[model samples]
Target: MASFLSAFSMFGMSSLGYRTGFGALFVLSVNLVPLGALWYYMHRKTFVLGRARSWMSMGMPFGERYGNGMRAVIPVVVLLASIPYLVAQVQGIGLMVEALSEKAIPYHMGMFFVPVFISLYLIMGGMKGAAWVNTVQGIFFSIMVFILFFAVMAKNGGFAPTMQMVFDTHPELFQLGAKGGKLWSYPMVFGFAAAMCLGCICFPQPYMHAYSSRTVKGFKTMLLSFGGICLVIITMPTLVGIAATVIVPGLKGVQADKVYGIVASMALPDWLAALAVAGGFTAAMSTVNGLVFGNATNLANDLLKLMVPHVGQKGLVSAARWSVAVIMAICVVIAWNPNTPVAELSVLAFGTVAVTIFPLWGAYFWKRSTAAGAMASTIVGFGINIVMFIWGGKNMVLFPSAKLFQLNGFLAAFIAAGLVFFIVCLVTKPGKIEQKSLALFFHPALDGKLDHNLVDRSENEYVKV
Candidate 1:
């Protein structure tokens, strides 16, 4: 849960819920299927060796088959993905604090100086420290939000009554694809659903978390537990957003981002509400810290290390620290004057990282997967995403007759990348696979059984061309 769920998720879910109540659940339930399926495959890829194999080591698999191409491109995409999320977190803090303080604390005040704290902890303590902070924050936020949900439920005369009231007054909020709804309309749903699904599937942090499992059984347990926890965490805020519709009503535009804090203040006691506020801050902080460190490692291990392959561990550490400062500074500056809503920012992050999906998965499944195709897919996907983000904002493509049938940047970019990936793979010649190139991913034990030991297996691995 701590791996990816953050203020980005909480604020985004609430805003979605506020706009369209049960529509938020509809989106999550639809998107989470792909996210969970991909996560499972990614888990098998990393843990097949019976050890954690992502993070600093994840590049090894791609590096072996795809060589320096993947090492060069993946880091940039990962960096791009992290920025939107970092901006979302800072935006979350600013929105929540401003709402909680009743605007005595300005929005910028909440955003300002956050990067400083992230830089300090990440530069000094690294990802371990970030993970610890995320764990602690995730636990606290999870508990408080669960308690806060029922509190709001009781105060609002229970879930069914709230729904009855809303239906009586504003039925559009719960309609999944109502035409006149501000955000829950079909066009909007298509875009956000793509964003949420890709975002959930492609974020780098969860892949790293997959590496922590020491055993297959333990890994399954972790995934199952994570799935359940995600349902709870996601449900609480979504319902809170629904409850906000009744309690506060009439919030328009980006104002819906503050629904979480407003509802907490209305439902909980003064002391608990304050704790809830603190929980919100911690949620934002945890995600920021994690992204900061994640970006730092991406710079040091994947990008920088390739350029200077001989750098020792000490030099890498220094480079990662420097990367933290630089990256955090950039994110803070952008967050300071964000033009995008927190929900949109989070969606953009998902679309950015998702560019790598074809480049990554093709290596394991497709025999014709080539480095050129991988690199081209990365560039094409990223380029299309940038184009659509800037030029395709609220612009729909295809099925010109009906607005509801159009596709958004997130889905369009992903599809374009995959198409290019397949074309490039067919046109280009693939490198040798029957060697030590994929010993780790294609262990000999994988033939009919499982083995934890490192097997010198490559000649017969993934060779069906």
Candidate 2:
């Protein structure tokens, strides 16, 4: 459920769809493919294996292919990727709060206040607290927003009239090429879709939550429900964008980000608008708590374990709680500026983590995968992604209409990562294959005949067996 929210910020999605038109829909559709792959992969793991595959304790699963260096590197990437994603959620709260309060609260205060509230519960209950909060928030977010979505439609004389207005006003939104001043190209649309899809599953927060599931049956059920929720959440915002284009035309530049706020404030009653704000608040808060929990635990368990092994469980838990507060503070500081668009910042976070996909796939499925290949891929993919981002703000081109480098950072980073991972793996020495771990991936289901050795296996420490 948290992963569902993480994939698309509420205001961010509406703005992107409003700004880019049908191109946003293409990205949203393709984004679900990776979740299906994630479900299949996790479902195949031995039920007992679920408990041990966290970023901190990933040695058993990744040790055979990635070795210690890459295993250690995963959490760092997760931590970095998580921070920006957290900031996007914090920024979402700021946008909604400012909108809800008529700009009296201000963005920085809203960002600061939301995280403090979130940190209190996160420090108190850890993952259990996050899960309960997610359940309540997820329900509130979907129901109240669904109400707002339909109300917005009705106010504009229903979906048909709203869309007809958009088609008549912004015809390029429905067409393929750069009609109606649309910026997204065909390749750009599909490429970003692939990146979003791949990035969604590779993100560590969702990956971290996978370990908490108790049964494969439960996991599959959750995946199904998640897919349904994603469709509903994504669809609502896209429709909201289209409706906003009709209701409040000429929302240009950063003003597009205010579509959700504008719509809720204009169409809904006072109580309904307040409910919409609460729903958006819950959505952002739930996601932020989950990310802080994941990053804090990674620091306490994965990074510090090698440096401070003397810290016992109680000490580690204390460290985790402290890390939560510290990380939330850092996010508030970063969010104060709010430089990038919420959706773009979210895709940036996803792209940063998507680079790991090639190495991860190689580790899980390929017998000849090498540690050198995985490490090289991780470094190059992320390095190029960062460089391209600094150099090219959005289009990855210095000047507008520069045809030489038209690719978005997300697609470019993903392709570069995959190519490097493949070529390096082929040339480097084949990594040692742990038959014990290999057996689980190679024969995940075991045709319903379970192997107690694989199912019951547990690792107390990181050992390069």
Candidate 3:
């Protein structure tokens, strides 16, 4: 999941540091809250709800526990959310490839190359294949960060001098409102971080990845490993971004996203710059594969199987492979003419899907969480998110005439989803169907004692209540 921080995402991270200074690190660090949430909620959810058939079954924990409505809704949302992110990864690959080859390869060609090459192996290897690739990619990106960190520090006359430069020249970036005006206020930072945490926890791909783990120990292993890896990998981009501000100042608009690439190309020797491109490639490619594979799996297992139950396991794999090819083709076209900034694109994806947070987590802990509530939260919350996105001027504002800082679309949608969930659940009692489904995730001590009441609480009883 750390690889989900694509090269474009790293670019955004660094850009955040370049513009906002130390404040950006706070946004990156809040990722752990979701990791902790995953450990507590998803780990058990996967075992209890996901273990019935193949761990990789279509509806997964959501469908198994919630009902057919959720089983249907989650796959479509997961597939849609994966698109922009896939484009971002492809765009990142295109940027670095073009830079490394000095424009010989060109952006369009590089974009095509990454998806085609990765998909070839990805189709054959599946999730387990992605696991092996991610391992190597993770190590390579880690080494890349250390090398860039030390090199940037050395070029700026060591750590103390670098800190002195930022303090003396750009100290205003640290202030909540900055010196002259507000760029990144405390509230905005909190919202962005919280949105990111929620998105990561509820994002479909990561849920599928969690389900792939064979044991509780493996799940815990992933939780710990992701936490430590994020701490190291996420911080690297910030340091590099801070260094870029000092060394290569005055980058504007889309140019700022290329800060790390520019700095590496200029500051390092030719050989190291070539290696840096490879590092970026590794980062972006790994993420692209995971996103593509996860979405493809959803399309095949969740959607197709429901349509054609006679499809065999081999047929499903073939369906997944074809889905990857088709999705990558769509992403290539989108990457060719992306107008949004890499960071905003990422944050936008998070904000849009963050509506899932309440519905997803509530299933595990909230006993009264009926399928009606889950469906309401998913549909209404997502509807509100889209409304806010348009009302906020795409990616520009929280709502009409409001700026980016105050109560953005993500927070608005998240709050709306929670309110709807609670209100709907309270007003409408759970039907016998929902009560039976809920029993799987109930506390073990409640077993046997409530079976009678659960069996007796039919739709008729619910209507009377």
Candidate 4:
């Protein structure tokens, strides 16, 4: 449990660690608008209304009663999404180590270190071991953030001068326009907002917490607190990045992701610099642990058990540990390429999940959603996103567009899939079993009872068909 909390904290912090002032400004501008609303909703649903419990209870429904077919789909998509995300985290670890140690530790060696440590602790202590390590690391990261912020501020002549310098140098960054003069285009802003919102809900790390929390209310509280922490951490890094633009304006050809490191090394004293590096490393490790564990669980619970029904609980847990090790190794190899940007990689990972599973999951409680329609929508949505990713024109592609198309792949997929679902359900008939299952899962009257009669009917109908 400690490790899990640490992992989440790291993931949240890391998201902000790489942001430069411009990037941070961009993210904050978007987040600030809806953050209050999001917080209120989460507080009411997770705490006051207890909707989080409803969300948690929905996890096992497709597995236990929807049949193995539904179960089979989850692990494949989850593993696919998790690998790149893990690779990105590993890459971040490598970059941080190389920057801090002044190349005494090669990037490749640093990459290997995270996977090795994670595999060892996870294999030895299971989730509990991982959680403890994360807890300790999370504390280290938080301290490092405050230390770095103060050090940077002092170096740049404190907050007022720092703000003045940013305003003078990069006035456009502070501007609110959406065109050539603005730092971020409207489409990029909206795309980022959509991805972040959907990503949180669909992310395996968050979902794992949902399943592991002591109660629904607890889960909601943790997420809300975590979200608030994320806003602060992300804002700080952006401020640092903005400060970097003023102090180190001539840094040529350096990507925005590396701005934080560059600023820290140039502005802070040695000890603070070292702490900054450690904080970045901690962030990467936390995200890696969460993603690797998420993949392991998906494989063990959603895939293996479904494919091989006789696998016992003990056997499944053992397999999950081994799977974590193997998956971490694969992610290490993927991280070796060292070409992709961290933000792009993160978006790609989250975009895939948002496009493929977000809508399907949302349908669980919506009474009109049909299994067949849901399946078709998922297939088409994923198919469209993949096609756009592979063949869309230079400007239209999601990742590295030559000309910005404004619309991201996930948005395209979401629209496409949602349309398909609506049309298909309107045109076709839903199975009786699906309807009964929906009612059993969503109906308030069930009061947590599994309607066995509906299950029997579903099985009988399946046999007949």
Candidate 5:
């Protein structure tokens, strides 16, 4: 669960930091509003437990339940989408190392080192080891952020003076683009929020954490604490990024991803600079390990089993370890090329989750949501995003235009899938056996009891077991 929190915190800091400095209050609200709702929903409804049970009962604890067809669709999309996401984290480590060491350590070396460290703990300890490390790293990251924020503000004449300076220098930065400003347009801001909320729900790292927690209560506690911590980490860095825009003033040629490193190296002392470097590594490793583990599990449990059901548990675990190594190697190769910006790369993962899995899972639990609806929504939503990505790459249209069209993709997919599921359920109707199976899986009264019968039978037999 801590690893899950770190994943959200890392991306939240990287992508949302740009909007932070100008309108601290407004940006904070924008980021926290959806988080607050998620937290509340988790608390009041025991959302994690319900979700976990649903997945597990469906013979797909790792997301195999939407049928073989759906399973085939989701895991491949995740693996593909996650490549750029993982590479961006690798790039972050390299960029930080270069900024702090004055190019003493080559960028390739830093990139290589991150994945090696991640693979070590992940291969040795699996999810358990990753969570323990993430907990410690998350604590260190939080402290470093507060220290950096206070130091930067003190050096720049405190909060009030800093804001005044920012306003004088880059007044447009403060506007939310809703009211004639440009840092974030109204549609973009809302789209981002929607994507993030859906991403949190569907993301593999968070789902893994939800599964690993000792209890439902523990998971809920982690979510609330982690959400609060995420808000602080993100807001502070954004402020720092804005301050850099003012202080550095000559950071034009450099990439936006380098904003944090540049500010940390130039503004802070040697020790503080080292701490910032450590903090960045903490963020990078925490996210990397989680993603590696997520992909590994999907391979071990979903893809591998589908092809080779006879593979023993020990063999499965070994395969998962190797999968992590292979995935890490691929990510390293991609990171070296560096085709995408850090912000864009991170958003790509979120966008994929929002469009693909969110609607599918949403409808699975909602009475109004049908399997067909979920499936349709996923196909259309993902297709639209792909087209938009291609178009955007060619400089034919901006993301906002792509998103406007993508919205229809999501809507059409959701409606189409939902309608199909409803129609199917009504027309070919479930037999008593099927109803019994659905009731046992979906509304089983037992809190923690294992439905051994459900797990023991073959996939087809279990549907009526």
Candidate 6:
């Protein structure tokens, strides 16, 4: 996920930072909100269920607690929302490739090469392969980000002078509500932050990582470390974005997306600039590995196995590998000539699917939550965003925390979905399956007790709720 801060985010954040100034940092504030919620509730709810303990893949808890509608639809909603984001990352790589090669390779051809390599490894090693590659990628990009930061700052003389230049020309950009709400306002930032936290629940990649954990302590430690990594990764890009205002100004629309590359080529030596492009490519491909694998895992483990009951283990493995190829093809085609800015696609994806949080939250935190409610809210929330996407046409206000009348479309979806979820959950009651599932989750001692889907070859016994 640290790669999330690289490539597309670097490209997107720099562009967004040019527009929003410091307000772009709000994107990294998930630790403050969701960490507290998890500590108080979700950890107790099913934290232990992750340790080689279940047949439940992706949002299986929802299926167990609610019904098959959630099992079928949640993954679909996630990958649909995720494809735009996958396209964003792929496009970021394509742009960097074209730039570094000075158009020797061309954008159309450059984009196809990396996903092929990523899909190859993921087919052979699966999640373990993706993990090892990301560990190396996370380290490389993290260092490159700070180097790019200093390279940009040094070009403008130094840190103090960089801020002074901006302050002298456009002091207003320093404020969170820069551009008089054309870019970002306080309400917009708050809404986007909420949307991201909620979206994390719907996103399959994080949940997939959890299943790798052997203990609660290890998981919590890993989660906490990500906050520090986020601060380091996010801070430099914001500075670089702000620095670009002076280094390369008057850029608008998709032109702004190139600021990260343009500024790098102008400031650094040719060799270093080439390395920066490689950094972007590494960052992008690392995330491509996860996004493709996560979606395929959901399709194979969560969706396919349910649909094809007679399929053996070998069949499931083949389905997962094949599904990765199909997903990569679809995303690459969409990415070929994307007009929307990279970061815009990413955050929009996050905000749109964020509405599913209503049902997701209700599942773990509220006993009254019913399957009917989860199904209704997921579809309705996603539908509301689709309508706004169409209505907004070419100029979407919800991108980069831009909002109108202090109401972001993401926030609007949240309200509509939350209202629908609460109403339906109140009107309905649990069935036999739901009751059994609820008993399993609500139980103090989950593993080796209740109705768990344990592998039966586990090691760590549950500490008991």
Candidate 1 ranges with C-alpha deviation above 4 Å: 49-58, 178-182, 185-191, 394-405, 432-440, 447-465
Specify the poorest-scoring 10-residue window by lDDT in model 4: 43-52
RMSD of 3: 5.7
lDDT of 2 by residue, 355-438 (tens): 887776775567677788888998888888778768766556111233435556666677788898889888887645433446
Candidate 6 residues 209-273, lDDT tens each?
A: 56666556665666666546566676787789888898888977766777788888988888887
The TM-score values for the models, in the order shown, are 0.89, 0.89, 0.89, 0.82, 0.82, 0.90
Worst 10-residue lDDT window, candidate 6: 450-459
Extract clashing residue pairs from model 6. Answer: 444-465
Model 3 worst lDDT run, 10 consecutive residues: 450-459
**Candidates' lDDT values, in order?**
0.70, 0.70, 0.70, 0.59, 0.60, 0.72
Q: Residues 303-348, candidate 3, lDDT per residue (tens digit)?
A: 8877897999999999999998999888888889756656666776
Please write out the lDDT profile of model 1 over residues 127-208, one tens digit for every residue: 6788787888889888877787888888868877876877777777667564553456565565666676665656656556
What's model 4's TM-score?
Answer: 0.82
**Model 2 local distance difference test score:** 0.70
Instruction: Judge candidate 2 at residue 85 and give its lDDT.
Output: 76
lDDT of 4: 0.59
Q: Write the per-residue lDDT of candidate 4 for residues 126-168, one digit (tens) a residue.
A: 6667667778877777777677777777886898898787778
Q: Mark the regions of model 6 whose C-alpha exceeds 4 Å error after superposition.
A: 26-46, 178-182, 394-405, 446-465
**True-structure lDDT of candidate 1:** 0.70
Candidate 4 wrongly placed segments (more than 4 Å) = 1-23, 29-59, 64-66, 181-183, 250-256, 356-363, 392-405, 445-465
lDDT by residue for model 5 over 76-134, one digit each (tens)? 66777677668778877776677667789878787787889999999999777988898
Clashes of 5: 5
Pairs with steric clashes in candidate 5: 372-417, 373-417, 373-418, 377-413, 377-414
